[model samples]
Target: MEKWLVVLGIWAMCATCAVLFIRGATGGGSGKRTAAEKGVRPASRASAGDARAALND
Candidate 1:
C-alpha cells in the first residue's frame, strides 16, 4: 500500500508538470504583445524587388 501511494504521488506530480508545461508552451491566457500584433514594423524590412535592385547596381 505504501509503494502504491508513492507511485500515485509521482504520477500526480508528473501530470501536474505536463499540464503546466503545455499551458506555458501554448501561452494559455497570457496577454503578451508581439511586434506584429502591436502594428510595429521593423526598419530593415525590404521587398524582393528592392533587394534585387540593390544587388544589380
Candidate 2:
C-alpha cells in the first residue's frame, strides 16, 4: 500500500511537468528578439590569428 502511494505521487508530478512543458512549447512567453534585430554582426574569417588571442611579452 505504501509503495503504491509513492508511485501515484511520482505520476502526479510527471503530469504536472507535462502540462507546464506543453504550455511553454506552445507560446514561449511574450517578449523575444530575432537574431537579425540585434543589429551588430561579425564577418566570417578563416585565419587562426583571428580566433586566437596573443599574450603580451
Candidate 3:
C-alpha cells in the first residue's frame, strides 16, 4: 500500500546517501603511489641521512 511505498522510498534514499558517503571517504579513484614520489630512495645515502636527522630533531 501507500505505507510500503513510503518505506521503499526512504530505503532508496538512505542507500544512495550511503554510497555517496563511502565514495567521498575513499577518494573514489586510483590510489597508487609512484616509485619516485614514494618517500626517500633506498640507494641514496644522503636522503636516508636527512630522514634520520629529521627524525632525531
lDDT digits (tens) for residues 1-57 of candidate 2 = 999999999999999999999998976533432422463233332233533422210
Local error of candidate 2 at residue 45 (angstroms)? 28
Best-fitting candidate, scored by lDDT: 3
What overall lDDT, based on C-alpha atoms, would model 1 receive against the true structure? 0.67
Which consecutive 10 residues in model 3 have the weakest lDDT in total? 28-37
Q: Over 4 Å off in model 3, which ranges?
A: 31-57
What TM value does model 2 have? Answer: 0.47
lDDT of 3 by residue, 1-57 (tens): 999999999999999999999989986445333533565444544556877745643
Error of 2 at 25 (Å): 0.6
lDDT of 2 at 52: 46
Candidate 1: misplaced stretches above 4 Å? Answer: 33-57
Q: Tell me each candidate's TM-score.
A: 0.52, 0.47, 0.51
Candidate 1 local lDDT, residue 20: 96
> Could you tell me how far off, in angstroms, the CA of residue 29 lies in candidate 3 after the best superposition?
3.6
